[model samples]
Target chain A: MDKKLEPIVKTMQEKFSAAHEEFRGEVHVFVNPEQIVDALTVLRDEYKFELLSALTAVDYYPQTSPRFHVVYQLTSLANNVSVQVRVPVDGDSPKVPTAARVYATANWRERELLDMFGIEFEGHPDPRRILMPEETEGHPLRKDFPLGYEEPQFTFNFEEIDLRKPYVKE
Target chain B: MGVEQKLGNMGVVTTTLENMVNWSRTNAMWPMLFGLACCAIEMMSAQAPHYDMSRFGMELMRASPRQSDLMIVAGRVSKKMGPVLRRLYDQMPEPKWVIAMGDCASCGGVFNNYAIYQGVDEVVPVDVYVAGCPPRPEALIHGVLTVHEKVKAQKLKDLAKS
Candidate 1:
């Protein structure tokens, strides 16, 4: 693990019983979804990880136990060190405590996670769809979300497509 | 100067109203100053001194749709932007022409997804499709000239029918 991240990882493991792994000189400390806000608050207030550089999620399809891993990459601008906090989320209507109180940037990042991965951030202020249009239905980043496509209009079916295609009548 | 000298004392220069109207419309078409994406850069270059869009009598791009006679859709149209594009198209006066000035505006290019409207034609009628991933300034000039040609061929009787 990176020299700067080691102490923080050790501290998280000791205090919250969070599991951690080190790879390629970087550390990932996995905390329970319910304890995410507390963990993030501790990191920000005590460890000086004031900047939430990124808060995104990864979908792990076929892994029902925990279908998503919401990642929070925190940076300590004063110390020039960055650490990652991960919260594993199960697929069935997964919810996690909001870290907005800990980091202001988490507000928009968490909204994006809600929009893309369908992860609910409890206690998030002004929670709304961030990226996608207001009427968009599914969480686009989810594995089951359809990658909508258009049918190529070849010469053979060009006439057929013209009939069904939603071109402006005027 | 030359026309005056040629006319001499025979001061009658008679022409049909249709010919006069079409000629004036083709000479001074005001395209709306709207740029959606990268293709807009090429469109600007076309308007700049190097390509000199003024030679075709397009002195200035109208900032408002009400004043413009043509719209050059110069980039990808996102779903969110579709309604806005349609609203602007509706605001433009009749006899206005649309030139879909890039692959994205013409047929959604490679962004064949839900986020991007498949083609701007789904929102407004396109008079011409200039095929390029942001075509060169020369290509845009050619598209503008093509629109002029289309205007020239338009029949007054057809305008009345519409």
Candidate 2:
């Protein structure tokens, strides 16, 4: 609610007039995915929202349109303020531009976003799984992934196999 | 003379021997570092300065199974981690104790997902079950004390037999 940000809001409202408005900030406006990178570059260079606190995607599957939403939370540590920007994308191709140029911390968060949600960061330096093993199929944290797939492959036969017997090679 | 020296000089042979045994056992309770999830945070907190667990002499947390005498299963054991956990239990030396430190560790709490192992006791022999989503630090301390009591009882039984 700073007096200075009044003109910035006016400028966003004037320029991206057709963009679907989800939320607004002291000086910023959340725009569609088409204008997200442009809006971010403006905020970083012109408006000084210099820190990207966190970035992640929320999947809203089975929906007819906009099946995934990428959330970008940026901050101005010096000013102690934050703004959340969400961009809805198609489930088939979840792609977004990397914010590494804007804030260095987005490098890892972008990679996690790609690995976990299957979102592609267009210019991400290293997009890879952060938690799950590379061999692990499907994102385990997703709502749809089955909990325990099948019966275990191994078990002990404590009764049948005699521990008392001398060791013998199989 | 110090209290320990006075106790030694007083000719209380049985009590002195018991104290000596307890002192050594309490000082060397090597706990297995098994952090499964969020409850691991509470486990870390209990180890921090405010709790000062070193006072009762059980602050060493060993990563390897061979060296540890106490296994603190600090969070939910997922189906994936179950076999690995069992392997660790088997690796520990005999006379080792297992502490199921949370509701999840005792009986797979809120994460009733098929992925979670219902109860760790189904796999390993649990000596103490500290019941809570994440048990308070005092509860963990009580669980350790209970383990100490059990150890003392076993020692006394061994002495009686000898």
Candidate 3:
């Protein structure tokens, strides 16, 4: 456990009953999906973690119970320290409280999370797809989503590949 | 000075209509300012002082599609950018040529996924395909010269038909 993160973990454990673990000199605090805003607010106001460095999600697909982990990385400029806060949400219709109110940069990160992982950030100021096109149908980052691979053209398969090429003819 | 004086002394030089038109077109091939990804950097480097693209009559990179005669698709074409690429290709006037300059613009490079179009040929007809991850300035110059050669060989009747 980092000495700097010790106080944060102790406060989170006492206040919100959040569980924490340390790995590679970094601390990760696991909090309930609904308690995300509350935990982030406490970290910002009390610990002076004013900068929200990153807000992203990891999809553990095919596992129904709490399948998505929305990870928020916070940085403290004054202390020169950083910590990660993770909130687990159910796979089916995953939803989490918006941290955009606490950190303005979370708005785009939350939008990207929704765009790539299909995890909705409730009460986000502008909830729209950030990376993908507006007409894009599916969340591409999901494990089950197809990669849509196309075979390469080589000397052996040149004729076959050329035939399949979607060339526009006038 | 002697060659210039001799040429000046002669009033006119005769040439075929096809040769004359192809010569003029090849000498002043203005490429459009179209770049999509990292290869765009190489394309710009090709135009810089060291490579000196102006020697081949490609001094001007016109931003408007209407004024350019060549389109150098110089990078990866993402799914979102595919329509825009096609629209730009369509906007160029007749007798225009396309040069796919780099591995990505030529064959989607290493990105064989749903996000990127496999090759730019899927959208527009390519005249010259330069092969390189992001080809060097010399390679781009070679590709430009290849386009010039192709333009030189074009028949007037064939151009009129298109």
Candidate 4:
């Protein structure tokens, strides 16, 4: 863990009951999905972790207990340090409390997470898909989502494919 | 009297109306001023001073579809952009042509996925396909010449059908 972030991590762990682990000097603090907003608030207002660098979700499809880990990366310009906050969300329909209130940048980032991972954000001012086409059926970034490959037409299959290929007509 | 001296004031040359019409159409096949992705850069290069597409009578790239006769689909077509392409193609006047200007616009190139449409042909009828990741300006010129060849070959009766 970064030496500068030690006391801040200690405060977050002690006060919010956030458990933290360090990998090669970078620190990640885990908090409950519901308590994420409060944890981010305390880190921002008190510890000066002002910038919300990123907000994204990681999918663990087969693991139903905690299927998704919503990641929030915070950067403190004043203290010259960064910390990552992770919220483990469980079940098929994972829901996380909106962090938009605490960090203004979280608005679009959370919308992207919602679009790609289908993770619902409680109290999100506008809960709409940010990237994909409006009528796009599934969250494309999910593990179970289809790779969306189309079979390439090689010489052997060209004539066969051409016979059925839907070319636009006059 | 010599032939030149006798025919100084008047001369008679004969050609069919069909030949005249096709000749004019091939000369002034104004392409639409539009581009989608990276290939658009190459398309611009083809128009620029270095390669100069003006000699081919395509210097005027019209912004309005109603006035244009050719659409050089310059790059990949995303699913969101497919409908707009079709709408523009429909708005173009009769006897218009389409040149799918790159591998991406031709047969999806490397983007065989959900977001990008498999190929632009699924949206609008393509006349010539210049195959390249982003084809060289020479290749685009070649494609234009091919369209001219096609237009020249058309019979007068065929013009009525379009």
Candidate 5:
């Protein structure tokens, strides 16, 4: 960590007692779901991490205890530095406070997270599917979602495949 | 007047109605001005100065489906876009030809997942399949030529039957 980030990290540790790690020159802070907005706000207002670079989620499905990890990447134009903040939420009904209050960019990113992982942002301005169609049934990015593969046709199965191939009639 | 007098201007150019109709259709086929993905770039390049697709009488790419007789489906069709594509095909007048202009449009290319339709043929009948991730402009022109050949082989009586 740079000399400038040290004090911010120290303050964050004192305030939230959040676990912090340094990897690839970027600080990673693990915060409770409730403290995500506070941590991000402090990083933005106090530490000069002005930009909300990205807000996305990772699905660690089948591990039901904490199934989703909502990640926020913050960049400081003044300090010329960046940090990642991660908040883990339960699988059964994954919910996190909207970071939109801190970063306006969080609105669409949270919608994408909700669309892909079925994670909910409690105070999201417009909580709807961002990428997938409105009628899409399941969160496609989740590990449990099927790949929906279609068997490839080979010479051996050519005749059978030909018969099964769907063709539109005139 | 001298040449007409010398030749008598009496020669009859006799040909079957099918041959005349098919020849005209093949020579003046107009393609739709629609593109889906990366392959669309190649399609535009084919229409550009270098490849010069206008040489085949395909100079005008009509934006409206009603005026176009050929649809060059130039990329992968997602499940969402599939119905839209079918609707566009439906809007086009009869005797329209569809060219599946890339590996994706022909057989979903590398994206055989749930999102992309396996092939565009599922929605509309394809007259030609141009093979490439994004086929070269020359290859697309060749596909167009192939459609021309198919058109030339059609019988007028068959059109009536359909």
Candidate 6:
């Protein structure tokens, strides 16, 4: 955490004071769906947080209000500082603005987040499955999914492996 | 029935050739190192010190398909990587062995999702399947021993042919 980023942090805190009253220092203001892309753009162009290292989601199921938390970790190579931004969303129609325009790297990361947490990246160019198949019914990373599912083993012929054998008693 | 008769009646050269084959098979088992996911860490651990797999004669890890004799599919294989896995298997030299290292590689572990190839054996022929979430180092050693036994049996049969 450098002294130079203090102004950027303060500006962000002041701008989104309404939506993000629970803002901390290193873990910056966690905004809602509406301001996500704008905030990311400002962070990148204005503040020089050039690298969007990782975008992932954490499922908070069985809870009342927010069912998922999407986390975006950004790093500024010039300043050598990092910040984490989180946005909580409802499971039924979870949606967030795409950061693809701000950073090209967010394309696959957002798709993966969608695949695992079922969160929608609104306005994303090509939102598709990255890990799971296209027709996969449920997100396997979800806690609700069973870890181990029992199924029938594939049958194989054993007699084919015994071609050269003739019983020779010792 | 004494030493004189045993020396004179050395018939088929069975014992000598069988011993040589067993030694060669055990000495050089070149495993094709396949790292698919997280369990690859443990596979790497098995290769590193403390568990020093070099002692049992399987420390040589070949990156190329032509040179390697064994393939250790160390983690979960995604649907995308399935064809690649099969292609690598096809490229390897004959008389090759495959070891399915983790729960993911053996079977699709925690991911029952459509993306994963349920088990690597679905793509390639696996000789020994080491069982664990990521099988313990000792369990991997056991799988190595199992492969050794299969190799020894094959060698003896080959010797019997000549």
Q: Candidate 1: where are CA atoms >4 Å away?
A: A166-170, B1-12
Residue A2 lDDT in model 1? Answer: 67
TM-score of chain A in every predicted structure: 0.92, 0.72, 0.91, 0.92, 0.90, 0.79
**Model 4: residue B47 alpha-carbon error in angstroms:** 2.7
Scored by DockQ, the top model is 3
Residues A1-170, model 1: lDDT tens digits: 66777778888989899998877767789999888888988999998987899999999987977999999998899889888889999989999999888888888899999998999999999799988888989998888887778887899988776764465433
What ranking of all candidate models by TM-score puts the best one first? Answer: 3, 5, 1, 4, 2, 6
Q: lDDT of all the models against the reference?
A: 0.88, 0.72, 0.88, 0.88, 0.88, 0.76
Candidate 5 residue-wise lDDT, B12-59, digit = tens: 566688877888898789999999999999999999999999999999
Overall local distance difference test of candidate 2: 0.72
Model 5, A30-147: lDDT tens digits are: 8999888888888888888999998888888789878888888889999888888889888998999998888989999999989988998998999989887788899888999998
> What does candidate 2's lDDT look like per residue over A20-124, in tens digits?
343443333556776777777876777677887768877776672687778777776666666666777887777777777667888888778766777788877
Residue B140 C-alpha lDDT in model 2 = 89
Residue pairs in collision within model 6? none
Task: State the weakest 10-residue window (summed lDDT) of model 4 chain B.
Answer: B1-10
Question: What is the DockQ score of candidate 4, to 2 decimals?
Answer: 0.50
Q: What is the C-alpha lDDT profile of model 4 across B1-162, one tens digit per residue?
A: 134447776565457888778889988889999999999999999999999999999999999999999999999999879889999999998888999999999989999888887778878888899999889999999999999998888898877775
| Fnat for the candidates in order | 0.59, 0.14, 0.68, 0.59, 0.49, 0.08
Q: Considering lDDT, which of the candidate structures 4 and 5 is the better prediction for this target?
A: 4
The 10 consecutive residues of candidate 5 chain A with the worst lDDT sum are A161-170
Q: What is the TM-score of chain B alone in each candidate?
A: 0.93, 0.84, 0.94, 0.92, 0.93, 0.83
State the local distance difference test value for candidate 1: 0.88
Pairs that collide, model 1? none
Candidate 6 residue-wise lDDT, A32-132, digit = tens: 77887888888898888999988888887787368887888899999887877778787787888898888999999989988887788888999899876
DockQ of each: 0.55, 0.10, 0.62, 0.50, 0.50, 0.10
